[model samples]
Target: MYSHWARFAVFVFCLTAPLSIAIAESDTGKNNPANLVGHGGPIKAIAISGDGKTVLTGSFDYSAILWQLDNTTTNKLARRYSEHEGAINTVTFIGQNSRFLSAGDDGGVYLWDRASDNLLMQFKGHQAKVLSLAVSDDGKLAASASWDRTVRLWDLDNLKPLAILKGHKGPVNAVLISGAGQQVYSGSYDGSIIKWSVKTGRQERPLYLHGWGINVMKWLPGKQQILFGTVNGDVQIFDLKADSIAKVLIPHQRPVLALAVSGDGKFLASGGGDGLIRVWNTADWSVVEELNLSFGPVWSMVFSADNKKIYYTGLDDYAVAWKISPRKIGQEVQGKFPRRFQKLQNMSLGERQFARKCSICHTLKAGDQNRAGPSLFKIFGRPAGTLKGYKYSPGLLKSKIVWNEKTIDQLFAIGPQHVTPGSKMPLQKISEKNKRQALIRFLKANTQ
Candidate 1:
């Protein structure tokens, strides 16, 4: 679906750390923390283990981190996996938490063994970015929805593709597997939800036609109902028994990006592009609590097994776990967050140009390899792809282009795709000559 508009680049590097690394824990207590800091870029997807003892977060940094959750003043980060060539979009613990799956912009689905922290398999068939993934209750089957307008069913046990289900007129954004593993439901940007028979590999029936694009979907506890959040900020519940929409709620004026159902089946949390999170009581579908996330849009969310906390991800570099029981309306202080790319009040024209054109993917300091793109420090005289640790694309590694004033200006003048064809650099251009000059001047002044 590519629900978020931002794009991040990638580079592979050797890992030197062991399985567990000690990180400074926030003193915000047990149920909630201000943030879990690890990923160098914005978090995009999150998943919690059934026992609530562990958390897995995927990010635009092209890595997924596993964390040990507890009530102490310190949290132990278990491991980090960085096999993907692009940003991670979805991650889930499957097969009784013994194995896991992660898919992303690279259109590749990765299966990993949790205990060994080793990649077991990689499934590739989708032609575009994979948006969502769902596993059956028994964990024997998995389904993936992609921007290619197709849904693929996989035999999780065999780690092979089982069937390709296609019917959507537009990109498929969300998918769900039935409790018994008999049916798969897929929702698309075309505003239609279709049910497919897993065994027959055919569309059994059309579920519902939402007026707006569906961004996310979750199954209610008993499997008799489905809850979905839309691109137009509407959260609607569909009654499977009645075969119609039963309830509708507008929690945000912008796109509803994330939704999570509590493990205990007591509460449902919905977050949107408006930076608001609304908690609802499942029995009555009434609002129980509201949180204003002053940071930015919510990208993904998950509930702790105990139902007392909701872990969410957004544009911020760190992921946050919010306390749910006390029901306090909390919000981050605006303009005070520590995001690296945030605009300063006294920023000049050249600075603004850098912030807009280069900040999201590139860093300015030496030894700052955490960002998606390589650090730009002392780049004015370097040859392309000559950085110490970053793994550049084959085309970039063989390119004759050097990082000079004329080359840098021309790189963005026509776009990276034109300047370095087949490179990992995203296709972005500064159409205005002055804006290009300002960005180049800013890079020259700061990158040294």
Candidate 2:
């Protein structure tokens, strides 16, 4: 099995100043014109409006941000919505950019008004995390795939559930609605793709099956073909009419996690766990551009309206753009390195342990609340779930456990799930006493 895939900047800018000046001031080092850097955690989902004037990104920080993009100026973070209780997994523009939908680990699919930045409705029914979302061509219906082993169809106009397409035998990982909104397709960890009738929630037929789990899927132009990426790194096209594989693309050595097609259907882009992205010309399926991010796995990607640029999100806290036009195909992407968690020579064992275990989510410094977890600075005597401005789960708040050497040691020894049930902290355990001691020592020394 694939056990290697680990789950994978806050820029403040003056509002009244010129947009270019704001980006120039905040974007020092690796930040550039092609980067949208404002999220507190790794961006998991990205969507661009039809006009390409706006961008939406969902993140592990449990927030979705709206951004303004223009030809004359750099992109600016416009608004942030943090209503979700868990990490956001999918986001898309619905109803012609006037509204949008966001789904997350909390199993809630939120409908929002784009203009007012208000929550219009919360479509809740999924028992587990929602992984992917798709809207119909006419924008009247939407489908959401969830780990609950179901794909829920929604009437976008009525803001209600239309049907629960429940044929998948395993956690549904990807979902797609046909162009005419008559059929829905879902791919699952069970390695089967099932096509369902949208109106009756009945299984139409099994489309295809592979040995590996399907990670992402997309409907190609004309709806006669479908492109999908698998956990085993196979990017293949399935001809719907023939019910057979049309083309096979082996672009990555690791799991293929993302697939995107341009609005005009001229290009296709795929990203994988190897931190590589390949852009293909759909006409001939020829590789036009390839980029080595040298950072982390890409989780989501979308092409700009003009199809000249690709916007993608990875483990980094920002969305990056790659120029895919012929003029800028091979240009090197600069300055995303000296990662905070990267190991250096002669580091202590405790420091290394911190880096491997806690560095990605918890920062050691105060005033650095840009990560998913609250800062651990001065954590020795702090009470659990008491950090200001950091949202804590109700279960954690009710636990009333104080952070001290004993509690901290017990936390890792028992794991967060046992110590604080229902908390947002991911399941982690330090079974080795020496390693736990090292991590605790590192936290004690650095957290001060």
Candidate 3:
């Protein structure tokens, strides 16, 4: 997309400044968050599978990792596509649906069979590192922008060079193929955005958006408007058909380096040298949400299939995934289940103790099924009979114990299973009676 956006000072390695991550779901349909995915290295680029079942991310660590979307704590790494000499700079979903293409400074493009983590094919044509990549709408061709000052089109099926479109006087920085697959647009250091006829390999339009080199450009999905950023600080939106500015926006406090739009095209996000990614409402050009990259300069950003999450890469060592809707400090609320406190709000001493000692695998709800242990919300005022959906120690289940204050005190002293028997609560005790009493009070408050 190319209108005009600006640039700022780049963050070098070892840069660590504190920036908080926050979210607001009221304007959109987002609700309380459920989970988050974390990456091992500074994430450089990210792409989501069409079905939203999987996510693809490229990192400065020289690896492209595919992640299953459903599991949050499950950081199981699947399909480590290796072969590139340098870090993977971009990964995009193309063709039939789950198919992916990854390219990097190594000047290599590798097609991947996502299900098997298999390399379908590799294409080499660029003389230098491929800086950006785009897939044709019909998925028949993949276009690569490179420092070599050339945009090479590769046959998607054959992994062979279909054609080389050369015109940029300097390293090509960005590329986009129209959804109709009839046109290709490339931006370069020469400070111009050139549209090319895909059928004839000829330049169609060349629009200079800024005085300086273009750093990034993206086409708004299903529209004639293109959004772009430059080496200075200007962000502009243009009506591609008319070649006029539709809107000029302040996308970041600094240079905008990366951009991604939500599937519905209602929201757009920009990553910049300030190590921050800002989200905006497209219809009104209002700022919606902003995220700060804690470790590195934000290199890229991507939305998940459900649009419920956005993932970004920084220059740091790992990728960071964020919940589309998160409860912010002072905005936390009690949910349908007890013991589910809103984020960052002050909790009772008892709740703090429970969180520290027992929340690792359990959800504190009355009827919810156990995670690693049984729910205990309704246990205080109820009999200690074996709960359904839980495996109980034999001695405690048949004990038919009553939950009395004295009983709780004793159980906190001796083991609950030893005092009763069928209890499966791990062996844990508070040596201080006052702390034990406080925890019991908190548990009792929620149980009622």
Candidate 4:
């Protein structure tokens, strides 16, 4: 999220000069405005090209957009690829930004040529949503993690399935291909990280285990270590040689949803449901800075090619960029709602409450529409985990509870995690009974 004045500053800068030069000039001060704002829905994934001259973003709008970065002109939207039938969950550049890969709730991976914006090929095998994707160093192979509880490897050259690596007890949330392209690592909702052999498609042994599900993970460059973000708000670094967690950092109060490491391997960034992005120094693992971007949960983040700026997306409809400066600390940026929702004078008190508290992450529309959470339209009579395009937690998928007034009230009474453990929904407890009742009433009225 960004403040009105901050957004205005960026707007003026963009209108006056090329973005690259504007950003370069702003580096002189830590108070400079640094956020890019132009998306229609919550962003799910972000990737930077190898040359650092381009950016790729995937969104719940069911499209991935390509942006070109240059000093001579404003960063322009190069293209918008809308081939996916469902919300895109993952996107990655294949080789030198010439081609890229994307996968979504439709359970298919699509390859695209950047220059032509053409769908080169479609690879389908997973029976469920693809949550994460990774490309091998050689760019010859791609690995995808899926809600099917399996990791599918694809031969990029042939555009065919190479192997299906199994063994995770729960849905795989994150996957990574080794720099040498010999090993594949996957983190799952089962709270285990498993390794697989690239040649045989056989799972090795569990590398690490925690009490909470792994939400995101990244491999440290040129090392046998990994940084993992957990659903319980902890980030741990696991050492391969020691086969144990070497360091644990508690930087978030809610689930850590995203993690990114700078290309130079000097900085590590982590974002969480608390709407905070923390930068850590790789040399000493000390916190360098904390950015308070008042968005909802940050779903994705990536470092700029020069590693001087970081880009992130989340509950908001735009991707935000922040300059990484050692001199800046505890900086705050505010975001404004859309013009349509700015004036709510006619809405009732209960409706206003719902809009303020529940609307950021959940939509009120029908037919399986999903934001950060599933739609609540006609929700009172449906069973949990029945949303077609949503990837529900394993506990919820097996849940037998139906949504009624009593259950809905209890959901807010104790929180969603208490009602359905391991669900992706964050802990949001409405302790006041009247408040919960009012919110539920507003939901019922709107849905009906």
The best candidate by lDDT is 2
Of the candidates shown, which would achieve the greatest TM-score relative to the real structure?
Answer: 1
Could you tell me how far off, in angstroms, the CA of residue 104 lies in candidate 4 after the best superposition?
Answer: 1.8
- Rank candidates, lDDT, best first: 2, 1, 4, 3
lDDT of 3: 0.66
Give the residue spans of candidate 3 off by over 4 A: 1-40, 71-76, 294-296, 326-448
Q: On residues 1-448, what C-alpha lDDT tens digit does candidate 1 reach at each position?
A: 3433222111001001112112212333223344567777788999888888888888887788998887545456789887776788999889578988999888899898988989988899998889899999898898999989999988888888999998898888899988898999998888888999999999999999988888899888988789999877789989988999888875466777789988878888898776777889878878877766544477899988777778887766667767677644433222234345656677887788777667767888776765667899999989998997776778788899989989989998998888888776766788888988888888888888
TM-score of each: 0.85, 0.84, 0.65, 0.69
Which stretches in model 4 have alpha-carbon errors above 4 Å? 1-34, 71-73, 326-334, 337-448
- Residue range 198-217, candidate 3, lDDT tens digits: 88887776865467677788
**TM-score ranking from best to worst?**
1, 2, 4, 3
Residue 27's lDDT in candidate 1: 30
Cα error, residue 203 of model 1, in Å, equals: 0.9
Model 4 agreement with the true structure over 265-356: per-residue lDDT tens digits: 99999987766778898899898877654434667899987777788875556676665753444333334433122227787766866765
Root-mean-square deviation per candidate: 7.1, 6.9, 16.4, 11.7
- In order, the Cα lDDT scores of the candidates are 0.78, 0.79, 0.66, 0.76
lDDT of 2 by residue, 12-113 (tens): 000011112002112242356557877777789998888888999999788899999864547888898887877899999986789999998889999999
User: What number of clashing residue pairs does each candidate have, in the order they appear?
Assistant: 0, 0, 28, 2
How many Å off is the CA of 429 in candidate 1? 2.6
